[model samples]
Target: MMQATTAVRGRTERAGGKRAEWTGGLSRRSFPAGFVFGTAASAYQVEGMALKDGRGPNICDAFVKIPGEIANNATADVTVDEYHRYKEDVNIMKSMGFDAYRFSISAGTGKVNWKGVAYYNRFINYMVKIGITPYANLYHYDLPVALEVQYGGLLNRKVVEAFADYADFCFKTFGDRVKNWFSFNEPRVVAALGYDDGRFAPGRCTKCKAGNSATEPYIVAHHLILSHAAAVKRYRQKYQHTQKGRIGILLDFVWYEGLTNSTADQAAAQRSRDFHIGWFLHPIIYGEYPKTLQVIVKERLPKFTPDEVHMDMLQSVIPQLKIQNMICKLVVFLIVRIMNFLIPLASPGAADERNGVLIGNRANSDWLYIVPWGLYKAVTYVKEKYGNPTMFLSENGMDDPGNVTITQGVHDTTRVAYYRSYITKLKEAIDDGANCIGYFAWSLLDNFEWKLGYTSRFGLVYVDFRTLRRYPKMSAHWFRDVVTSKN
Candidate 1:
């Protein structure tokens, strides 16, 4: 267990006579020695030149073509132009005193994109040169269009082999420089949003033109778990010996709170959690799906073969388990909010408010709520429920409306408070015996947010969409001060 000093309040006055109040006393010293502090962004979300530099199209490229699929019918063809401006981004991170930068390796299907590979080579080399450690994620919702066209993507077991090949390529190629690797980012989101709700790339659902909502989500999830295990196994066997790198999977969890303290509502909340995170984490850690899921989903859930069961059991001993827990909101009646993934029996009742009270202040995104203590609950829950595995608060931040001016965007006091509060809860969780090792803010720069596109801004540095210039917001400054503070 680790202990840190209690956070104290302080205020800073901004240029326009606005006051930004935060628990400014919380500094890097609040964490254990060697703990990591950094910012995180996905390749599809931040990398521009989606089709340039020999880059092949991804499922998102094809999905954004449908009318009104993304906000403003927008595409990530040139988001922040990270493909061209990674050096500038890394400089910003270094300037802010970040110890690491978590970015994804955006590989396309079919042939190897040498230009894309060269670009990441330069990117990783520059990060190393600038003293910024690179944490590379292998997948982040952007499956190759070829794989989807070939065999239904994650729906078919074939994807497991393809993904393992891709992961092996990444490990053999970039694992030398990137010390930390995550096999997948939010696999649950991939399975649920893509198959269950039809809201994301390769969209398919019960009512959509293609896909079986009930069965496909489970099948996709099962394959994803297998894919992660295969990747880990390959890394451990081939790369881990010589490259000396660490690998794990990233999971997204929304801390679910019952609308009421009644036994039924509490049970409903538990069900939401089991369906949400337990779907993946349980299989990886315990070699099977949660009993709640097995009972509820019944035969719809795929059974792991004996060999696959042994593979899952092997994964349980992984050193690091990166969890991306954000959106500390209240849920009711086990809405699960995973669309058709849950049958009608689960009931739909996800609300940030109950009996005329909000869970906390709502953010610009429909799902994000500013319930800070929910972070503590989430981390503590993972620590207690999941055997206290080594964890990282991989992604946690809120967004402001994207339609603001550069001046308005840079003056992001709300974002400052959001980080201050949420990070404080994270410290409390750590202090209370959660073996969390690091924290990464959701994003370093605003780029093409999926589904919502540019309508939501979740970045510490504000980027002018037209000019592609970067300006660190108030939150960034706060982080620099805290992270570099000698106190």
Candidate 2:
């Protein structure tokens, strides 16, 4: 029944017919059978029962305390209150017919917090009862405050032991129910935003009061990769067999198209990609950093142990970005490579790297530009580079300003359009033989967006921060029909 409906939708899309009126003629049937569709969320962003019973503060809790860190100084202390209302949220997702639910474990004190475990157990049980597969990520930017103050988070090799111990607890506690495990989500972001720019939790950077962006990002990333390997090794050694689960890491990927087709510009674009996604991924896949990075960054980049170079059960990702005008950023990265011996910058999101021109429509965020084609290039690049590993389009969505009224909010035609364009390109990539298995929108609710705080709305369900009520936006209904479609 689904295949037939999908075929009809495909024909209508090709014919430019009535199906276009509803959802651009796309639906879950539009992709391969068994491809998962869901929404993604992180612990700090959604679960707001911070410090309730036996909980501990995370680095984010500390970062937001410093004035002016988050937009409007907003905090996720109660953003969306998912900790208290996950049952309701799970119900919504089940009714929407999404195949999976992607969320993270909350950060806690060094010891296992049964209070945290109890909440997840109930949440996972509800999801299982309703047939929603749980994709649990072990970490998502929220390092326990103790970890940072005690041994220096991610920077010191000691973090590898601490993280593995934490991972062991999670695997032993939840692995029976959760089959899909992600060791970390965007570890590069954790290193870059936290250590290199001091823009995130435990903020540290060259310009900050006490950081060495020149050396710390690489050190942090190296430790993160090692930590991930340790977790994967432990899982494989003990639980993976009886538990029947697969583990992987999520890396943020961005495509860099040359500014003008000039050879230098083109070379710069390649460097941008190598510096960004290639920085962490290359090491795990081939046991070393990208050759370009090793040559440029030299000793700043760390080497992996022979034991640290094993294959993860899977290679998953959240989303891919593209930046075209990184012409100037190329020079900056080169300079940083000389000064710090690290891949200092990422490819353009929409060509703002060193003020190069942009290719497509701009969004509210200065760094974001709509470039659907970039998604195709990103997944395809990963396919070619990493021997065609299975991937999850774990996150892909745009945000509108939060100040938009409820009436104007659900009319999110722009966001709907963004999803349409990006997903279509993603489909194109899959058809071209990329090994993508699923795609999740960035969020389920307009909870706190890190850095931007409540200033951005990237949710398909419009959230009224005042009432904490969730109203399905146009995109939500569109996604519903796509998932539950029977033609």
lDDT of 1 at 43: 88
lDDT for each of the candidates? 0.79, 0.75
lDDT of 1 by residue, 15-67 (tens): 33322234446888889998889999988888888767787888989999899
Instruction: Give every collision pair in model 1.
Output: none
TM-score: which candidate is best?
1
Which consecutive 10 residues in model 1 have the weakest lDDT in total?
1-10
The residue-by-residue lDDT of candidate 2 on 29-122, one tens digit each, is: 7799889898889988999988686779989999998898889999888999988888878877876678898899986665677878899999
lDDT, model 2: 0.75
Task: Extract clashing residue pairs from model 2.
Answer: 297-341, 323-348, 325-351
Global lDDT of model 1:
0.79
